[model samples]
Target chain A: MEPLTVPGMLPALEEIGRYVMAAAAEAGLDKRASYRLRLAVDEIATNIVVYGYQPSGTEGDIIVSSTIDDHVLKIALEDTGPEFDPRQHAMPDEDELTRPLEDRQMGGLGVYLAFEGVDDFHYERVDGRNRNIFVVNRPSAAPAT
Target chain B: MDVNIRSIDDITVVAIEGALDAATAPIAQQQLLPLATAGCRILLDLTGVPYMSSAGLRMLLSTYRQLSGKDGRIVLVGVAEEIQDTMSVTGFINFFTLRATPEEGIAALKG
Candidate 1:
């Protein structure tokens, strides 16, 4: 599928999600896998828009592209906003996740869940843009299109 | 996202329709947070919510924190399977009572 370029803003998240869903559908991902991919993409895209772009007081576009193979489906999000790596962010530990609501820390849960939901996640700074790659293994029974 | 609030006996039924994600979470928060008062019972009807991201989870956590130790109760009804799985992974599912339907959720809140 063709790559989607959406403005890195809060309102553009819905468009980003639609692009991801379309890619997932093209890959013939099942409901569970599709939802996971969508969540993973949504989380990182939000971070790019909210933390990376909005805070910098500059506007940018998030470039989302996907590729499907017999083995896995890969989605990549590229943004030219400030260089930020989600992997470097501190995720909630097991204790934090299990802690009572009042005792749990609020930040990082989204990033944590985003990476954890996918089969594999990778971050790289290619040239000047930050690229986040998410991989979800296609089920064996799913026919290759 | 659309948030509709109605009173059922003493419980406030907040029905949210549409995807509950970062784009729409603030709207849900704006409408739902004000209903979290001391000793308030809230039944969140999510039958129309086809998808939810961590933003929605954060809103739920915030609401839960507000009601904690205040004798307030909150229940979730008609949670989609995918949303439930996301909540389970984040451990947010354990924080609230889940029911299959609004009737069950209202009963859970009352009981």
Candidate 2:
């Protein structure tokens, strides 16, 4: 599918999600995989709008593209915002995961969930742009139990 | 996203429809968080919610914390399959009671 380029705004998230979900379904992803694919895209796209563009007071565009190769669907989000690598963020530690609800912090779980739902996540800075790539492997030919 | 608020007996049910992403989460927080002050039994009906990101999960956690502080209870009803898996994987599943339907959730919270 052709890549989609949209302004880095909160409302643009749903557009990106729709495109990704369609691509995932076309690639023969199951319901579980399809849901995670859209969610991971939502997480990254949101960061671009909120952290990357919003804070800088500069307008930017988020370019989303998808491809399916060998039953693996890869979605890449390239943004014109600052250089941010989501893969570098620390995963929630044992304490963060095990802490009681009251003591638990409110943030950080988005990044964690973004990574958790995908088989692999990649990040890179190219030409002064932030590119975050997420990969989801299609279910095997074998039927799900 | 559209939030439909209703009350069944003493339980407050918030039914959210649409994707609960960053843009829409604040709307939910604004309407649902205030209910925490009442510290009454709450049921989050996600049947209409087709998708949820981490922002949605955080909202649920914060709401759970608020209710827990007041010794009140919150249950999630009609949770989408994907949302349920996300909660289970994030360990958020243990924090609140989840039921397959609104009736079940209300029964659990009221019991």
Candidate 3:
């Protein structure tokens, strides 16, 4: 599996998103599933860049690696930023999600969708580095257009 | 991302193409928020938008908030199915009116 390492910043998200989607497609993920994989990776990468590195003005980089096992694709993102477990943030409750636009709050919504789009999500603090792992199960056939 | 703002009768249409991810969402927000706040009846044409990330959701939510207080409405047109799934899962799909085409969206907004 080829690994991609890039500076941790919002601008890097465009390239990162493209890489993850290509990896997903290589794993035979359908269009919808590939989109979800891209979404999941983008959310986590954005969080690491925006909340993890940018705030402290620390120069850091995110390393992304992907592997396919059977029909499942596993993508892992490793960053040297401060260890903040995105899973620790509680997902937005249904009430919060369903609230009227005037009353809806933005907290946790991005992280919530990140988790929602993937089949499984795991976070680990390895050797003082933050590692986020995501898995997507690809369907045998693409959805009908 | 390409953002084209036009007017069809009483509806203000903003046509966007490309992925509405983190990098592009801010650009869209910058362009759409001002119009939404100005109480323009807006129809977001997303036929060219193949995907949208959470940042896009935030922009839509903010636009909704801004338009709600005013006598303004926000309608979505040509939203891709995958985008619709994300919106449905996040529970934000119910807040906006969705149509298959920009003409339908404009019609709904005008009606």
DockQ of each: 0.81, 0.75, 0.75
- Say which prediction, candidate 2 or candidate 3, comes out ahead on lDDT: 3
Q: Cα miss at A27, model 2 (Å)?
A: 0.9
Residue pairs with backbone overlap in model 2 = none
DockQ of candidate 1 compared with the true complex: 0.81
lDDT digits (tens) for residues A1-145 of candidate 2: 8999898999999999999988887778888888888888898889888889999898989999988876588999998887788877667876787777778775667778888878999998988989899998876762322
lDDT of 1 by residue, A1-145 (tens): 9999988888888888888889888888898889888998999999998899888998889999999999899999999999999999988988888888888887898898788789999999989999999999888888898
Q: Per-residue lDDT tens digits of candidate 3, residues B18-94? A: 88888899999999988875557889999999889899999898888787768888889899999999999888888
The TM-score that candidate 2 achieves is 0.93
Best by DockQ: 1
Top TM-score: which candidate number? 1
In order of lDDT, best first, we have 1, 3, 2
Candidate 1 Cα errors over 4 Å, as ranges: none
How well does model 2 score by local distance difference test?
A: 0.84
Runs of candidate 3 exceeding 4 Å displacement: A140-145, B37-39
List the RMSD of every prediction in angstroms. 1.1, 2.7, 2.9
Worst 10 residues of 1 chain B by lDDT: B87-96
lDDT of each prediction vs. the true structure? 0.90, 0.84, 0.86
